[model samples]
Target: MLQLEGLTRRFGANTAVDGVSLSVPAGQMVGVIGRSGAGKSTLLRMVNRLTEPSSGRVIHDGTEVTALRGQELRDWRTDCAMIFQQFNLVQRLDVLTNVLVGRLNHRRGFGATLGTLFKRFSAAERAMALSALARFDLAEQALQRADTLSGGQQQRVAIARALMQQPKLILADEPIASLDPRNAQVVMEALRDVNRRDGITVLCNLHHLETARHYCDRIVAMQKGRVMFDGTPAALTAARIRDIYGVSEDEFDTAPEMTAPALTPAREAALPA
Candidate 1:
């Protein structure tokens, strides 16, 4: 289990994530939804320690996450893989080599690390990377430069890299914000596949309510850095959504609807079990 006790972060006088606390169990797919500047990204960053918390504690499976340092912190980050809005891949590198980079933390001593830097990995590791790529239907593109693939393809490559870490949890911050509707559906399905098949817990920050409703097991809504609602997708009523977005009921009714396409059998089969 992952527990956040009064987690807070402040910059100058403005608090980004305010005294928020939550307990997430393993194998749950959670969607964190909120408007822009609602502190959703900051909350995930604090959990990953990419951004330090000003106060409170982050405990994961009995380990004090907020107090870890050096290798311990690095290991924590490895176990909790982060997928960003920008994909964060080495554009110049081949997809396979970029995926192999996830093993950098597992590389022990100077020689191993140096070998990884030069793109030298064990045969078993190479096979593992290939398997991850195949999981996302990117194995054939493994030798292509990352920049050459489409946005959705690059994001899948990023997911493949995360899988190479064998992460227990995934923190996805606006992962599909930049993709088109079709690609967004594909990416979200990939995330759901990992959560279901591999039993990896997912905490994804989503902008679209319908997408979250369709994909997540539970929904946590934030407003101005505070969690305003926490419940199953069906329990997130229209009134609650309006309240979280601070919009009038009429405005909410007229808002453009964004929904992911239904997954077909062929596409579902394409994603590895």
Candidate 2:
């Protein structure tokens, strides 16, 4: 279980994330959806210690996350994996080797050095890498350098790398923002598959309303450093959206075209299954 109690973060006098408290049960898939500067990213980063909170505690499996440091901190980080809108992989490294970097925490310095982010892997590790890649249909590109793959392919490779870590919790910040509609579904399907089949907890940041409504078990909407709404997709109505994003239905309808369709479960499964 992941729990946050009175979580708050501030920069100077402005609190980017206010007194937020929520608990995500194991295996739950939660979506953080809000407009720019709504503090969604700040809240998500607090989970994996990427952004230290100014106050409050984050508890994961009974351990206080922020209190960990040194080797203990290193160990805690291994339990969670983070994905980003920009695929943060070593550009010169081959896809397979890049995935193996996820195992760095498990291996000691020298043993971990055996396979740098660009080198080949051991027979056993190679098989493990292949399995992760196969799930995202990037096994054929295992030997290809990260820079050579398409944007969608790179994102899959990033997901494969995260899978290789065998994380208990996956935190993604605007993961699909950089993808096309088709590729976005592909990546989202892979995430939903792991969340459903393996029961790994998933927490993602989404800009599109339909995307959050379709894939998330719950949606958290924030505005001006506060959680404005927390409920099912059905509850994120026009009024709630306006409260958080300051955009009413009239404003949305009158503005330039910005309609995006919900990604159905069938479409999520339309990936390389």
Highest TM-score among the candidates is held by which one? 1
List model 2 lDDT by residue over 1-273, tens digit each: 999988887765567789888899999898887666678877888888877788999999899997998888777777888898898999987888889888778776775666554354568777998999998898899889999998889888888888778889999898898898999988888888889988999999987878888898998877667887899999989887776566874553334332223234364234221
* Model 1, runs deviating above 4 Å: 248-273
Cα RMSD, each candidate? 9.4, 8.9
TM-score of each: 0.91, 0.88
**Model 2 superposed RMSD (Cα):** 8.9
**For residues 105-203, could you state the per-residue lDDT of candidate 1 as single tens digits?**
887799998898888899999999999999999999999999999999999999999988989999999999999999999999999999999999999
Whole-model lDDT per candidate? 0.88, 0.81
Instruction: Provide the lDDT at 222 for model 2.
Output: 73
CA error at residue 105 for candidate 2, angstroms = 0.7
